[model samples]
Target: MKKQMLLAAMSLAILSAYAGAAPTDKAADVPLKPAAQQTQAAVWASRVLSRYHYKATPLDDAMSEKIFDRYFKSLDAEKLFFVQADLDKYADAKQKLDDAIVGENLQLPFNIYNLYQQRFAERIAYARELLKSKPDFTLDESYQYDREKAEWPKDETEVKDLWRKRVKNDWLRLKLAGKDDKAIRDMLDKRYANYMSRSRKLNNEDVFQIFMNAYAMSIEPHTNYLGPRASEQFDIQMRLSLEGIGAVLQTREDYTVIREVVAGSPAGMSGKIKVGDRIMGVGQGSTGPFTDVLGWRIDDVVALIRGPKDSTVRLQMLPADAGPDGKPVTIALVRKKISMEEQSAKKTIMEVRDGTVKRRVGVISLPTFYMDFEARRKGEKDFKSATRDVARLLAELKKEKVDNVLIDLRNNGGGSLTEAVELTGLFIDRGPVVQQRSAEGKVEVENDTVPGLAWDGPVGVLINRGSASASEIFAAAMQDYGRGIIIGEPSFGKGTVQTLINLDRFGQGDKARLGELKMTIAQFFRINGGTTQLRGVTPDIKLPTIADAENFGESSYDNALPYTVIKPAVYIPAGEVKDIVPLLEKKHQARVAKDKDFQYLVDDINYVKKQRKENMISLNETARRKERDQQEARAKLREARLAAAPSPDDPILVPDPKEGLKQAVSPKPASAKAARQAAAVKGASRTDDGLQGDERSLAAELEAEKAAKNAKDVLLNEAVHILADEVGLLKTDTRLASRVLPYTSDR
Candidate 1:
């Protein structure tokens, strides 16, 4: 009997594994008719669920057919990337799915669905039987998934831990409301049954969502099909704050690792919890050995973390990266709600200089393109969003008389499409900002309908691999229109539009349950005809930041679409750089050769790449200690070269992070603070133009005397050399100096 039970368990496990999903493409062998395709898709969906031993949905084979009929028929061939062969294959697959759904000779559909249905019914019956007996279980009340106060279920002893927590918590709530345990349990059980039954009938979405996300990848990363449950989860991810321990977990090899802890959150406030921490165990409250959960799925782990806001839940975190001690780290944190506003966007100022020329550049650091979608859906147009804040900032900058601006869109994942269009229009005079194409072969241009341009001065856009979607769109359009200069590394490649559609709406009484898929509906293109989907925009003057090619780049993504260009639209270039390209190139080479920052950046990149390449790396103490030593060595080297500000007694040093004051000073931070970083246009128009021997010689003699007085030491000498070269551009045409400089003083 024992051996028989073991064998049966193994067989059931195997069946459940297949239930998760029959290979993603099960219709490959059989061609599907359009109607049949719906049935096949439904059947395939059922098979996927049954393999996982999950419950069945209300959706049936007939319902599946109707959903596919609307869905597949809606496909715009012109919008798809399918070639002749691909289209033919797609058709065949659809036909096969339809045939399967139509109750044809399909082998897996009926059996898998029926088997899972029975399995679900058995679980429910068991629960019903427990209720019938009314065993002396705890009168517990807790919200397992719905609320934030739920606790983690420790072991097999707590498989129905959620039930225990929910019942206990619900009972308390009812008792607080003057109800008895009998009445409370009855109500709570009713609610539980209702929720589970509805969820079990989620054939359209819940069980097969990962595959739906797979479909979103068919267009771009941003296009996603979110199951209802997944949709709720995605909302939390977007806000960057979860009502949990505040630790970000990711799949590394086979184990889930703590990516980073949100500072000031309950987990982060512990100080002991750090980035790269691995969570091997979790304790429900605080009394016993932590429960081992090394092989749990990411979603399961997430469910474990979230609890009622302000409720206490201890976490057992393993040390992340080794520190000075070169040993393992163990940390405990009490879960708490995270609500730190400090990390959000704010305005800052940067002063640039070129000799005596000074300029103040306004910088707005937007953390993310965020929107309160819920409020907006409630018809609140005045709800807080990025565009309003930015518009206000631009107005403020104008009041300060700031001409140049740098909008830092780095690390900005796109939010609302409305904002992208509105923000892009803020730059150029009224016109189309981007072109959108739909799966229905429909093309439309999203225009900036605003009355006037916000700013007409020089704009420099900085982006990196983290800048994606709306960021890419704005950058590409700005670049195409010759409205701004792009600076920094390439952006993240993601430029697709997604839409949410409910799958369960097709029919009533279906046995299958499924959710919405965020599928790609269209691809966006610059008005000038280039898609920012896979190949992000190229910057005019690339700066060396940590986000350069090595640390984060487009090469990291899977199934990234190819970069291609279409016919260009007639649009004016942002700036006339007739001779600027060669000039900028020359300047770049000079800076690259001498800039310590650039050199340091190169070394850092090489080191990172080396670490990434090495395999079979050890995580033992010896290797860890060596890494710490290497890091210390780097810190020491950096400290030695750090630019320091002069004391009150010494005025020679300039306080500037980007300005290498020690290496070269006089173009003080204050002087060139506002000067654009572009290569200065050269000319033979000298300030000291031709004058009689008396005037010219007098001016020269006076200039020499003043130069001597100003030239105190090394920094001054270097500054003098640079300024002289730039200011004396026309001096070589020595005579032109006479024509230009004579009126300088009088003017």
Candidate 2:
């Protein structure tokens, strides 16, 4: 489901301006249908939204105006492309957009898009012309990179000046990085060309998706229109089973970047690919010639890499920080199905000693609430699931006789709502887990009927802003029941539900394939009556975190559902820890007040905030170089101080000894045959390509060893201390223990 969700939003990448050598008069006749002629799919999409959207916004003049404004903003958020005149010229279409959508007329949007393309082309030509001459870097000026709130350029001349400064800054940055003039120009030329060529390839479907999405998103931020390709990709991702290299790919500049490698998958286990590595080329099998993928469409690259099970895909990649002169490295991986093991619940036991007494706290880190729905439907006895895995892990922890359990849900973005409810059942007896309110104001209570409790011991659930939807449901449920103490940062507030509606399903036989609509149809609320919409579940024990609510939470989204409360559900409260919270908080405050790592984190966050406030960097070459040098010197000083200081005793403050080793070494395989096959592929590829595999392996291992020494986690260590404190208090304080355990009457 995570993968499907990724693909659904893949096509939403901003189409950045791509400058190239001046073209012959703005390619005026680039083919496109007039905007007034709406496709059957467009009409079907509009109808679907009106009937099924959670926020039933009317497709009227007011909505049309909003969509018009949003669509243009989406095209040029930075205000670099279109001028005020362009918007003014298209002003009449603002009110007519509502009529066009209802009347199944798309001519207005298409016309707007056509005008945008023309201006985009002209700007690219102008930018390319400016790049022909060297830029003046001696001027003491600042370039405002963020322009979301800035007004549009007043005229073509103003936009040209902005581009000139932008190009100059780009050139200066490369020059400061020690690149030769020729190298800088070559790289810039290629990047610009790639941008232009890619933009030129945008067909009607791309325009339609962009426009329709603006409309749907005006209704609610999560609601979107995915084109045919994006829809298919989303479906494949939802299966959570794919025969591919298991790397998330995105296009940045001219290179196809590896955004992430799924843990326990072929790419991840290979230890050859890294996040941000640029794939220069791809090959199939042993003998296939590597095809240069520069300027290629992202989907094209994705299709080339994704193949049948047991097949081989070889990636020629440049390291993330590589310069223009950097050489590409070859990595061969045997493509296989990325299984649930990568994202399943993982358990670790941490020992915290209070003076003479020692306690073992079990930590279960669940990345996402997931279940193989198709596999379960097929009657597979051991279909991998979050609830099932957590249940097994809980039993294991109990067997180990741990005093308390901490469920680390940090960075969990959520999946499968049903699994969230079932997983919540593991900690407590069945009851209403969450409430759902549909578009028609119909409320439904989702209950967990399972009677058995997995771990009724003292529990702590850790969360952060990355935790959303299903994560919030479980956290809020536990907090309400007094089943556990909530810790860490407040969660991501995403309370609404999205249902994927396949437009193809609505069409008759032989209809042109319309994409899918991820329409928001309902909002979820906690059993305690509050919705984790704009305001998510607040932790009882707050930790130092970099997540700012205004910038990072659901409130960041323009159309997110507001925080609201509903009638509380009838349920029994297990107990409350209002009395114990202050003590825990005091201990946390005292520990972090002087702790070196915590203080350092606080300083770093403040520095980042300061940098954000002072957003503009000096465009002058001398000033920029001096600033860079100062930063480097400070970084070196900090590094030396850390090296001279004694290592912290807590694992959270101290680096993980095996952390770097995990990344360097191949992940432990699920099957011996799979491991052997991977080994065989690596050996065969090395021999076929005449590569020095041993030398590379040794270098990677040595680097990993060095990095592993520096990987620290103060957050986890602090969480352990908090839990240990809870255990100690529960044992010594009768009142605290009484609130946590079953009441005397129930017993």
Candidate 3:
């Protein structure tokens, strides 16, 4: 089911908050409901404990009492089964156990554990009943394109209701999958057995997470407490490839939906799969009747999607935004292992101009601060990491005569502590990149080493809510140091460092235990004085996106630690962005008022919100067909826009720059028809809209193309005019920069 990682931002209002999100009550604070005052399982547990462990003992009463306390306290009292009546029943069980043990009945703890199984099953049966209830209106938030952190919802109830609906839908989905009552009970029993048999050491981590969440939320939202197992999992998630089709699936309304495809992954590469695509059915192996994966946990979906590498898996995706969503698209993909070498650090160079001056800007996108940890631990000096490769890429781009750069740290979740600090070093002349503070409050400034400033030119750093952790640190440092102009929406505030500890190290017999605890340790502060804690760095020029909402900020992150300030560091003032804010706001407003891309994003968000709010849909074929057509139309419209837009420099250029890089570059197509379309774009580029100064005829041709619904032709014509502004110049001579100046930001 869709796991709601949300919290009410306004709760307690403590800057440094961690679980329940904002600081407040503990497990004991929220008293159990009274209706479950006499739960049978609890009563049975008491009897079992007394009969087995305390039989014939003079201290049976006291022993049974203490054991019972541990038992109830150890249980997740919030599991809905532990109401006041359950507690009373547990107390009765304890008394019964005490009496039974006084008579030396020995088969107790196992029986009690069995009782746990029975009670768990029965409780689930009733919960299934509860789930048939209608779901609440939901406006869910998820990871932003920047990947720093999750965006928050506009309303608290919106997310809370999302969770409720998700749970309810999951119940209905299970029933619809043809699992009768017995099958459901058997499955639950097995799951329960697994939990009980888990290492006690592993289970203890739950308590630690609860405690750390309460403690960390106070510091900041991005600061996470990684109990060991979780940290390992986090590492795997950052690469945008997780052994599946790379779909961000979650349960929404009554369906498990495709949130968004990770860029460059299999799903993202498809161009056909998109955000809001829903998974209605999943066919495993060779296939038969489609098995519904809707309402399943993300983990379960992964299990269903994964297989031996190269094995084929069929997926039924309902494309959102592309159609009305009636019929599902069945896609079969062979699973493969994807590593950072394939997923991150994609770069391109774009040529733009302001009148007669042509400027070549390098755009580099770093997905995450990737590091080959396994390789590093083995002392592989050449192990790849973000800093290592990014540094090299910068050097190469400079060689290619790039005058300006756009470091696209969009969805880069931080990785490799050293890499973040080192990456920051590349932009600044020489100074502290970030600050780290310990629990005792000792702060140390982290300085950038091995840097004379990578490229001192006007730079723009693009970020969004997904730009978290190390990305935030880098952005904050650059902003503080006045190195570049920060663009895009506010970032996800995840400033805290998490340490993962393997429970297997401590629990020798717990190899089967997959869970680990992640705890927060260090907090990040900027060199100037502000912290990237809960409130991540505010960009110099804010760009609007669909990821906005008060709940999307740090305060909305559960159990986020509080924020506190320390002594300000003495530093030099950087350059100012004086009137940039107004410029940005104006530009964004103007764009939002007319830009179709901007409008489409808003529409997509609203559509998702609607689905999350709905209960169910009619499964009629006619309705499905109509929905499908609508979606296809939207998809075509979007594709038309993209196809008409700017095309990238030919990939063949790097290897053969000496082999005629001067002519107009055409778009790459996957097939012959696409190649023909590319040829048409190139043909249209010949008549200089501005290049050879054939402005009149070229403009008329463009206008005619537009009138004829040839947007691609028109866009290519426009690009020709734009590029003609600088025709004969090589990479640098006239097409790039004419002067060198320092890029400084006003912090």
For each candidate, the alpha-carbon lDDT, in order, equals 0.46, 0.72, 0.48
Model 3 lDDT at residue 596: 61
> Worst 10-residue stretch by lDDT in candidate 2?
14-23
- Better by TM-score, candidate 3 or 2: 2
lDDT by residue for model 1 (69-165), tens: 3232222111111123322334434334334534534332333233334434444444544554333324222233222112222332453443444
- Give the lowest summed-lDDT range of ten residues in model 1: 1-10
Candidates, ranked, lDDT: 2, 3, 1
Residue 582, candidate 3: how far off, in angstroms?
Answer: 4.8
Clashes of 3: 70
- Quote the positional error of residue 57 for candidate 3 in Å: 37
lDDT of model 2 at position 533: 89
Query: TM-score per candidate, in order?
Result: 0.49, 0.80, 0.50
Q: In order, how many clashes per candidate?
A: 77, 5, 70
* lDDT score of residue 152 within candidate 3: 29
The lDDT leader among the candidates is 2
lDDT tens digits, residue span 300-391, model 2: 67777878889998889999878867999999989887653544677777777776888888888886666676677788998767788899
Per the 3 Å backbone cut-off, how many clashing residue pairs does candidate 1 have?
77
